[model samples]
Target: MKTTAKILNGLLILFLLVSCEKDELESTDPNLLNSANSEASENFNNGMIKSYSSDVVIQWNELLSQSIDNRLPQPAEVKIYVMVTLAMHDALNNVVPKYETYALDNSEVDASDITKKNIHTIADAAVSKAARDMMAQVFPPSTATADALLNSILSNIEDSDLKTRGIAIGQEATAAILQKRSGDFPLAFAGYPLYTEPGEYRSDFMPWAMANPPVWPANAVYAPNLGSLTPFGIESGDQFRDQAPFPLNSADYIKDYNEVKMLGCTSCPARTEEQTEIGAFYIENTSSFNNRVARALIVQKKLDGWEAARLIGLIEMSQMDSYIASFDGKYHFNLWRPITAVRLGDSDGIDETTGDASWTPTFTTPPTPEYPSTHSYNGGAAAAVFRAYFNTDHCDLDLISPYNLPGTTRHLSSFSQMARDNALSRIYIGYHFRNAIVVGERQGGELGKYVFENNLREIKKLK
Candidate 1:
């Protein structure tokens, strides 16, 4: 009886996929798999592929930005982005075999039955379904929006059989990734221990927290358990952890201390106007900014669907692992932010340093351990992936700051230059010492290179 029921259920699903009209299936259940509106034409080309993939990625990224703006944990944001991209890549790959998949196995998605003529149309449907399902699963609040987006895309695909098969493949990819990442939620924040010793991290009073009591709680450390979360591509979170931050009373510490103290202050005379602008420009949410840059490059470079999927998958996965590695080192070292260090400089018994209780940073310091700057780390990882993917660091790219100075734009000539600017921004903003930025960028670069070389390689076709 159980075997008969299972077979009947399978037949019912097949019937829905093959026989039911698109509107009928959608009306039968609003929860059914749907499509997003893509600007892709039937003619396959780099530009068309960009239209197909970029629309899905960019929309989801907007959702991610909204979540971040609403104060979702950083780790959770990265995890969701990684999952969605991976699902999209795997689903597309399943339809049109190109690169090896990140999560889905060969047996799970057979593409031998798909003909070359129908590949692009079918792949677009698969990618849309995969992205929608993964986003809805990982970030539940975006379900309605995701569904609407999917419906818009699916409504445009006229072929019912192709769309149905694509949806099935996408659903299979989503199920694989969901199962792979089970139990991988960001751990609850149970509050970190307070330390009073010099060079140790301590939570500071946040005026913003007072302004919004519910979202920004007083003295809250941001995602202390982030390091413990599972990485998407890397072996483990600590695989690329940096060494401990500079010790107090050391020359390196003294040099970094004085640099930030003189320049990071809101009223510091040593800081130039350009430095201030640079600091403010890069202060937007890192993930959002990086994704925008990547998407622009994807369009500019004229990447096909396979290429775009691999590039984005690499960037997101590398950044995710970089965050994990940086967070691991952050909690392990438990170093104080520059604000804390400057306020209690003299207490560290370092004669070269002077305490300034009235010191204020140009920006509110992030509530996390300062060692191995996560922002710089993500920048380095992202730059590394870009450089590797393009086979060079040079590119004509322009980006606008999303926060601090919203309309300000910066043109960059190379990926490495952007990474360097990101590292320096941490110092100019007075959030991190120079040592942390340096080490963080280095660690991130290593992790990014590792992820690119190791994961999602192009499949070698036999003659």
Candidate 2:
């Protein structure tokens, strides 16, 4: 009897240990899955204005902006997108109309080894179903423009392609979008930035740049901070700029300022002396990234389509807010870019080491005042939000290019690493000082932390 009792106790202990290990390997680990469950009330704008296989998924989101510009209301944009994303992702997972992509509650813990080669194939069919259903909601031929546009937008799809199926589903989504809108054209375009033709620059841009010069600290030295109360406030721009590596009112700034104004418009291009290498990188690299996104959107399955659209929009919004904060901080500090300081090291009144001129950066320098990097802040902020979805220290995304650039590639280990790379690229390419990027990373992280801590909590409450 004593022997039997001991055996039973040992069996129970063994069972508990196995259960714990399984949970750890599966999802009991917060680091492996999403923990954000807070509800949100923000009328999901979908994007401030920003993929298929993750390429078709991209083009699909681009269409969102185009569709809205053509007359779709903000509410219509949100509804149509949400309906389609939800419907298609649902179909992909073999679920019904309302339960696609799993709710915040249903989000699963995907193991480290999860990779879907045929992910786009399944997403295509799901989106098609949603498109057809949504089109039924709109009242006119005009309402289904996205469907027509999509047909023309796609090229590589074969008869067996799921994307072709999504076009039909898109028709339904389009119609549904039209049904919900009241047809207020001007109001639809109300808050969008006023255009001054393709070539003309905004009148207010230069003024905004010139007037918002950064303010310097009283000492302008590298001593421990003077402990001013103003730093704690929300005011942006000047305070951050003063600490930047670039010197204000110097020739280096004039060169950068000129480039910012031209971005993609100037025939001269950034490669030439007139083009501050920054413009060259933007015109070159960013364009490639954008096109890649378009292709992904044009090809993804409906479920992935929804995920792609929602993610693209969400990231853009998050980035915009991040930029707003970083820019405000930069100008507030009255800092300079690294190039300016290193060039005139003696005048900087600091003991920091400066690098040689003629140093090329790994990435392009963006045209803006220095201190916190806009790219770093934006990149880091986007990464923070995405971390919840792909819970990994890094991603080895086999760097496939759908735009026919088969040879070009990169390996991203984590969202944070990607952000770090982006920030460092600026330095490698000689666009910013390392300090500016560090600050940008810090600020970007803080903004993202705020999203998870405050904004997401409010938004997820809705979830």
Candidate 3:
């Protein structure tokens, strides 16, 4: 009896350790999709079916990382979807006539006349096409799905600033440019420019990158593998494990220094006060997590065909618009994070504090100004969108993150609590201030409200 009991207890312990951890995600059965199908949900379901065809989730995350680096943010594929749906919705909202046009240039309205709303239309069309192209790229033409894709995009847009502002301008612009006899707005806008010169945006990165490119310190132990089977460069798999359990590319001290390699050292740098703050901001936000548990989670409601596309498109537009606003504020305040300010306590001429020679940030510092936490705003906007879809922010769900971690999963009963948790994680990870996170959360909630309410002038409120 004693021998049997010991074996059973050992077996139970092993089972407990392995069973609760998730590995492969179970694929949802197409035949067994959502069962509680109201008209709106049915609409969402149809769009989700369309969306399911594409691998938008993966691509979208990858695209967002190109600018601001973080474990979470809005996906690009959804953003494009919202752009398209907003275009269709904007078309419906066009109630104005031509003569109210403000000419952007005297250059000539020859074959094609340009207007703001028309330009917006052109961008939306481009987004849809890009999304479709990406979808087709992944699945063969016949397998490309739009059901989930549409629902996801619509949910985002219906709750985002992009749909509201883009559509706001689109509605007014559509009416103004549709004056009597020109397809000019539609035509000219199909390829209207949305980007400013790289010179302008790169100021934030150019100096940072120039001073830092890929480098190897004199004390490094890496050596090239002569064999073709191995990567010509870095060690792979278990060989590099003992020194560091995570990826060499994982956010680390050296990686932090490399971020501002482009910018030269200051010889009494004229902007000591400004540069140090920005440097500190960079140092604080650039950490990378392969996997980390998240308190807030995402719940996607399915919408169908045209409406799904439009609604999901609105969600993305809302996020993008919020980001633009957020980005604008980042540039506006030009503030510094606590890490840098705290570290350089003596340099700033403050006598009360001392720099910790061994101090390090918990996570990587993202490369942007810090005022409003993007994570907070994005989380709040997303939470509201989900609530709008469900008509309540009370769904209990688990969020399994793809931050490259082996097993990052979190669960919550209500969407709002999850949003709060996601916002609070910044403090847990120590990258943002409580004030910034709260402000971001407040702004995001407002942004979500503005996005949904903006579309309701023509109909009864959805929720």
Candidate 4:
């Protein structure tokens, strides 16, 4: 009797572990649940059905570029990505059962009657309404333009009971998310005090080298305090901050200095024609490029609307967290950009380190202090999310840059390759050290893991 009781207890413990392990699991099986609605899900995944969420994202990408072109800062751009995607995911999650919604609590939104609704009609109305509404709030100046575009899209959807119900679901999701993010205004920390230290970022614009271009005469627009913004899944901004960059006079610093000097200079002899092109290809802003990549890959893989929505939402949330974490490292370490470091190299008292008084990067440096490159971090987070959602690193896909490289379409063998190229682009363009790229990639990958493990996982149906 004692032995039998012990056996039963052990089995109970094992069952609990298996059931609760969803948080740590990276991949979701397509057939994880077998329900009476299995055929509908299969249809959605196999491209027999259209995906409304995918359409909304592709269209929003265009408007997002316009906002950035009008000089929306990087942090603001990323926030735009997060809210729209989150709203879309929450809106459609009522009819689907795979992942948990981000801002909308299940108890708050009634999904009881939604199970019987057509996934296509529901996803269409919900994704469209949520995206249209969020854009109006985030980009007020473009609200009129956005509303017209949204109405044009909606006019195509025929009137039906399903459409009415779908629109309501979307509106509910929008209200919930908007209420949750109301305090997350972009200017929340606009006038926060800027930090400065021995090697920290400063606004003094002095020429580095005689041959280099003149210092940007205008005052630098200080990056907003992105570190304080609310994260979708992570507890705090500093949760994933990377360690500080290598010390100023270390050998590690010297090696990093020499490599960028040879390959990243405005007139670098070591940078090949193709390397320059790669750098320019990723010149598209962080939020826009990654979102474009995800959309392209989704079409290539033929994933349905719901699957595409989840993947995009997951990727954007991971990236937003990455940006916050990267900013924490940037402001915390207060490191110098390569342009500053290379120009001031002589003063550092390192015998091997030489200063190029005329040194300039291929492009102007961003205003923020440098440690981990934001572009690399975004790419790393994007790659991690794509790999986890697809359950493989080896996704054969072609990425056609919106920036029109010599060949618009760059064929890729895997998501990791795309990430590798994105990191190397910073070095090729002469803005970052190799260490920054490597560390940023690692930081992003870890953040991706945290997002997947902690948020959004397939749960058992209410069977």
Candidate 5:
């Protein structure tokens, strides 16, 4: 029965791939299998074929982003990406001998004694298998899509032994990562309570403002339980947590309120066309934007499989830790969003804060407690990691929005430039105050610094 089920599952997966890949199948690119051309190519497939490790990472990252966007929260999206990418890194590391393994949860597989194997074939099989299995666990409904990718990856390997070993290694890595993530952690979305006082996050707002689905529970003293998850390199989720938002009714608070009110409204005349473009470009969710930029940088540098693997692993782990730290601050303070403050300005006890009852944001407000914007945090985290990796803030990097423009790439002079723009973008879209973006950048920078200095560093290893 098990064998028959396997056969039937394989057939179903094939049918789904054919149905979904009508256009992709039309491309007759044979070089897809041997796409890498680095110093590492000399040792690949008995010196006959090159490895495509970086391409594998890019493809899998794109697929995973699409799958998670279909159904999952930000926390889960971060978690699954970390797992699948780390598995790919560890699997390739065993063959390349460049860095120390991340030491996944239940991983006990050993390949030290194996010899005369194709690292390219092994990497391809391992990455696809690890991604397929992990996605099955996180998004069971996405099995058809996941299986199609797996079939496509495996069908390209010509060597039987390399393919078999690659599958085995990938499976072992997935098990280890799953074991590491197993335990009590906050993975579900449940509501808490709302603060109904005059100055707090107002659950009761005008019909238009509150029409879209509430971030659920309307208002919770504590946000989602992201703090419960394990940190990558930080000692705790609150390790980088900072002070609360500016004191309500302070001069600083009044200045920030007026700035956002003038520039961040749906009908603000002060906002420029360039500012509006920046806002729209960054409107993409964190996972998609960060991953897309990271992939573009990796390809531009022509990093080999193991080099790309290690860089991607570090980037994702820092991002995950930064998010945890940001959420800790968000729930601890439970600050109101700009929309809430703008609508309730009259009651905030500030002489300068005149209430605008009919005010709307330039874009829809995200469903979460305000203060210490996660988008800003994500930007800072990614920038810091890139800066650390290149050993300079002056590296040339450009990010084009997948959602906003297909041909227009925004040229960033430095990683810091990108970070600063991302921090300020919330105001352009009327989603965050200046204080939240500023503090979120600090928290994320600290998290990124900690991860960069402490973990996934290069070590002396024999090839």
Candidate 6:
């Protein structure tokens, strides 16, 4: 009886071991389990989907930079960036339903035909096509380059149904965004009338000693119609318009006037060497510099295609809206720049301030109305997006300004630090007053937060 019992017990133990192994095998088997039902299957699905590199985004952004380099106005540059990135993001999500589409509905992307085996290839094709189409449309001069990039990307994928479907999806997304943004571009400038009142904006025709003539003719106002362009993510351009600037004779105005007069002159003895460097370092194109920083972070974080598209889209959209908001306030308030304010100080009915007609700024001022600094607004918006995307303020960034302090690298420890430096730089360069910098940065921060919290949110899966 004892021998029989031992035999049965050994058989039961063997049966239990075989059953456990079968369970483990079944749990990992993709054919037998759904990705949502099994952790192993979920990981396997993710691995397959995220296997591809997001260099497509980087490549397209580079193409955008090349196409827009000194060729288009700032508002037009912002608009082009927004359109390209939005197309990329929307196309990728259509292929893989990872994020909410900005321009298309769920019915627009027929993901029912997509499978895990071809998801990444299809996604890559879609993104490449969308970027190519948008770039070609916005910048016809770069069509050949954009075409080459798309062909190079598609070469990796075999000519199959997946590729064709991806192209269709991409074309659809591009069309949707283009249709959505139709009539949003700035109108032709009709010439702004010069206002002679103190504290009002008027074009300064003062010529300066420089190697090259300015991009715009002397006394020409830059992008006066920019304020009328429609925003991407914000409700309206003037939704966050700042309050009126300080009165010309107020104590606040007097203090800021004196501060810029001392620290912001072309050869101010009060300005420190480091402050001069800071002033010069941030003089590059705002869109270009911010995108460069963003691309670096994308590489450093090793983000996949979806993550990179989403991040770039958010950053660009935030910047576009911020520019719109800033410009709206700019044209609405029509405040005079520091150069005009300082030169006409004595005539402004102010007792304490003195006018110096011979005064010059460290850098030539932008030709827009200057109550709030648009550059500072861009800095604040970009920094907010960076911090929100990383969920932290701290990031190691090494930046160089080829436009100003060429070959000199500046290292920043956090996004907020960068924003602060950028805002203060406007003051040092004598382009903006402290109040303008402060208000612009604050408005940008608010807009950035609103956009990140609201747009392109992740599509949460049902349990």
- Model 4 stretches with alpha carbons more than 4 Å out: 1-71, 107-117, 187-198, 206-221, 404-407, 461-463
Of the pair 3 and 4, which is ahead by TM-score? Answer: 4
Q: Estimate the Cα RMSD of every predicted model relative to the unseen true structure.
A: 15.0, 15.1, 25.0, 11.1, 17.8, 5.0
What C-alpha lDDT do the candidate models reach, one value each? 0.78, 0.41, 0.38, 0.73, 0.73, 0.82
Report the C-alpha lDDT of model 2 over 289-376, residue by residue, as the tens digit.
Answer: 3223323333432334435544443444345455456656643554444443334434434333332333223333333445566667
Candidate 4 achieves a global lDDT of 0.73
Q: Candidate 4 lDDT, tens digit per residue, 26-125?
A: 3555455454366555454334334333666566556655655325656677777778888877877764545688877654444434433355566677
Q: Which 10-residue window in model 5 sums to the lowest lDDT?
A: 42-51
How many clashing pairs in candidate 6? 0
Better of 3 and 6 by lDDT: 6
TM-score of each prediction: 0.83, 0.42, 0.43, 0.80, 0.81, 0.86
Q: Once superposed on the true structure, which residue ranges of model 3 sit more than 4 Å away at CA? A: 1-81, 84-130, 133-303, 349-354, 456-463
- Which digits, one per residue and each the tens of the lDDT, describe model 3 over residues 1-463? 9999999999999887666542221354433443323344535433333433222332332332232334222232222333333333333222111111121111122212223334333324323333433333322231234334434444544344444443344344323322321321110001111212311112222112222324322211111111111110112211211111112123432232222221212222332443333332322111111111111122143322223333443455445444544444443443444345334434544333444433344454444445566667656765665577557867765644443332445556886875676666554444555556677777767666665555322221222
- Give per-residue CA lDDT, model 5, range 216-295, as digits (tens): 34332223678756787678878877587888768888889999999898889999988888887777766556776677
On lDDT, the candidate that comes out on top is 6
lDDT of 6 at 361: 92
Residue range with the least summed lDDT across 10 consecutive positions in model 4 = 208-217
TM-score of 2: 0.42
lDDT of 1 by residue, 1-463 (tens): 9999999999999888776676565566433332122112123333334444455555555655565432555566667778888898898778765667887875354554555556656877888899889878878888888888889878888877888988988999999988888877654444456688888887753223232344445556777777888887788888987467778978999999999999998899999988998899888656666777888887898766677777878888987888888989998999988888888887888899998988989888877888899999999999999999999999898887767788888999999999999889988888999999999889899999999888888654211
Quick one: best TM-score, which candidate? 6
Window of ten residues with lowest summed lDDT in model 1: 34-43
